[model samples]
Target: MLKLGWFSTGRDQAARDLLKVVWQRIKEGFISAQISYVFLSREPGESKESDLFLKLCQELGLKIYTLSAKNFEPGLRQNNREAWRAAYHQKVYEMIKHEPVDLIVLAGYMWVVSAELCQKLPMINLHPALPGGPQGTWQEVIWQLLQEEANETGVMMHLVTPELDQGPAVTFCRFPIKGGEFDPLWQNFKEKMRQIGLEKIKEQEGEKEPLFALIRKEGVKRELPLIVYTIKAFAEKEISLINHKLFDNKGNLLLEPYDLTERIEKHLKTGEW
Candidate 1:
């Protein structure tokens, strides 16, 4: 069986939900693997969401380890943050040194891991944009797309490198964000900005903007299923990491992402797991 190590901050309900979904899939035999252990960046009483997540893991009999970032942050000033992080990751490396961990999945880990840790772990992360698309958070990506008046957007699972959001994709799904479904909103957004000025938007909550909200909703609808599908691909060995590099089962290096748009659409239509 594939030995998976799950890492998540469990900062919000969505984080917990993602873990639950994966656990359920594993239980249903949808993924032929075992989550050997779970690592959290928060300790008990640090956050209710993480506490709840830990409670669930306990019920499921999964091994749990924690190295609290909150506990470690206070000792470091800005200049020493990088060095502190390296030591932090070293402690984590020690914690899991004996586990037979094959892969590390960053479900909702909020911290930027050190390059040293990235070198040590075979990790994959769920990014909110497609391969070769925007290079920041979902909010930044949506804003950039709107500014460019782009017609397409997507989500992907990519190898986690020291560079943020620039990793090689394993699997991805794209969808059109144009035409009838989008033009009305796009027009309204442009008109609103024209009347109110972009400065006002910068002052206000950008994520709550009507255009951003609509786009995020559409993207979120795909996030859960995309994560599940991508992990399924890894579990079945259609995609894998060999010597810390991504490749197909045949050992050919994956130069491009595997597209899953049609399969995702079909699965959405059937409403089956």
Candidate 2:
């Protein structure tokens, strides 16, 4: 069985929901693995959400370990945030040094991991874009896709490196954002933005643009499913990282995102977890 290390900040409902869904799948025998430990960046009382998340982990009987990023952020010499972050990651390293974790999954960890730590662990992260697509937060990705008039977007699980979101993808699912259901909305958004400029539209409407909203809805629906599928792939040995490069069980290098459209569509249609 794969010994998994779970890393999350547990900052929102989505983070909590992800843990629930993944744990449910594990309990249902869908994932051939056990979570060895859950490493949280925040301690109890940092926020109600994180506290509740910790509570849920305790209820599930999973080993829960925590290091408060808030408590560590202060007391950095020279006010060097990067230096402080690296030290904090070092502390995290000490906390889990003895655990036998095969892979680490960053579910909702908000901090940028240090390069040294990235080298020490095989980690994967959820990014709300396809392989070789826009880079940044999901909101930035959506906005960039719209500005570029992209026809497709996707969700991917990629290796975590010093770079924020540039690592090679392990698995992904793509969907079209143009034509069909999106044609009218895209057309209107383009025309409106051309008339009023993107800055003005953003100031006035924020993320409520029809096209943006629809695309986000489409992508959001696939996020958890993709994460689950990615974990399943890892647990089943369908995907592996050999020398920091992704490969299949046959040792074939994966040059493109593993297209999971059909499986995800089935799950979405069947309401399967």
The best candidate in terms of TM-score: 1
Off by over 4 Å in 2: 75-78
Error of 1 at 123 (Å): 0.2
Candidate 1: give its CA RMSD in angstroms.
Answer: 1.6
Prediction 1 TM-score vs. true: 0.94
TM-score of each: 0.94, 0.93
lDDT of 1 by residue, 37-144 (tens): 999999999988899989988988899999898787567725587888788888888898788677898888887788888888888898888889997777788988
User: 51-111, model 2: which lDDT tens digit per residue?
Assistant: 9999989988889899998888587924987898789899999899899787899988888
